[model samples]
Target: MGKVVVVGDRYTVSLFKLIGTEGLVLDDPLNLETTLIKLKKREDIDLILVANDLYNPVKEKVESLVIEQKKPLVTVIPTPFSQGQPLDVKGLILRALGFG
Candidate 1:
């Protein structure tokens, strides 16, 4: 697999760790533009996981960039207290990426 960058709040970062990504997880709540700029530069980053309480504005800005740059995207809901629970939404992303 490729590097996975988790973009969201701190709690989501913890869940990202549980997802077992071999790549780095960036805790980017505020500086999304800079984080995405850096992500765009990193050719090694193959997938992005976007978790948000509501709609993620950053997602709208970067989904096109992901397409233009040719990287896969995974969107998920970040439940505050459901870390260990299985996530069907995550399965949707994995299935779309052909990893499930």
Candidate 2:
């Protein structure tokens, strides 16, 4: 029903944008908190894809929003430099269902 968005570093943003994903590329980590807070308030955003590296720094804040607001599903995704790993689809489902 709502739009999906991505928030990450320049490389991550560029890669997703190439595939036609809409998002914001954060140039500075200092602004990550404020940027995420703003995105959380948007009624049009149904999901948010955050780079794993970036998400680690703001995990607490992000998780709190995910649990409390329960909208705009926030997910941490692997970055280009990370080793290949299988996605935990089951875990994500549980989290989305408020069971994780």
Candidate 3:
């Protein structure tokens, strides 16, 4: 079985850590490409949950890799505890349970 990895800010990484998921805190945008490349080489990582804030900066490159390689599926996720449009917890649960 493969693992799920989170690449984002300290807060984003920390949250995943609580659930025992491995993550990387990437503070510099300039190093984003390098970080992605390194993660791509890791065979144990099957899914990458990239924080939306960081993903937005390198959207093109990330999208291309996801579309072309199709390994280690990449997804953009909202920052945990971020202030924005409120999340629909109930709806999310329903969807997860295949009820929505």
lDDT of 2 by residue, 14-88 (tens): 876765567798866557678778988999877777777777776776667545656777777887765778555
lDDT of 3: 0.72
Q: What would the per-residue lDDT of candidate 1 be over residues 19-75, giving only the tens digit for each residue?
A: 665333445444555665677676666676656542255667555654565564544
Candidate 2: where are CA atoms >4 Å away? 86-100
**Selected candidate, larger TM-score, 1 vs 3:** 3
- The C-alpha stretches of model 1 lying farther than 4 A from their native spots are 22-30, 53-67, 72-93
lDDT of each: 0.57, 0.71, 0.72
Best by lDDT: 3
In model 3, which regions exceed 4 Å deviation? 81-100
TM-score for predicted model 3 compared with the true structure = 0.75
> What is the TM-score (0 to 1) of candidate 1?
0.59
Report lDDT (Cα) of residue 27, candidate 2: 66
| lDDT accuracy of residue 95 in candidate 2 | 61
- TM-scores of all candidate predictions against the true structure: 0.59, 0.72, 0.75
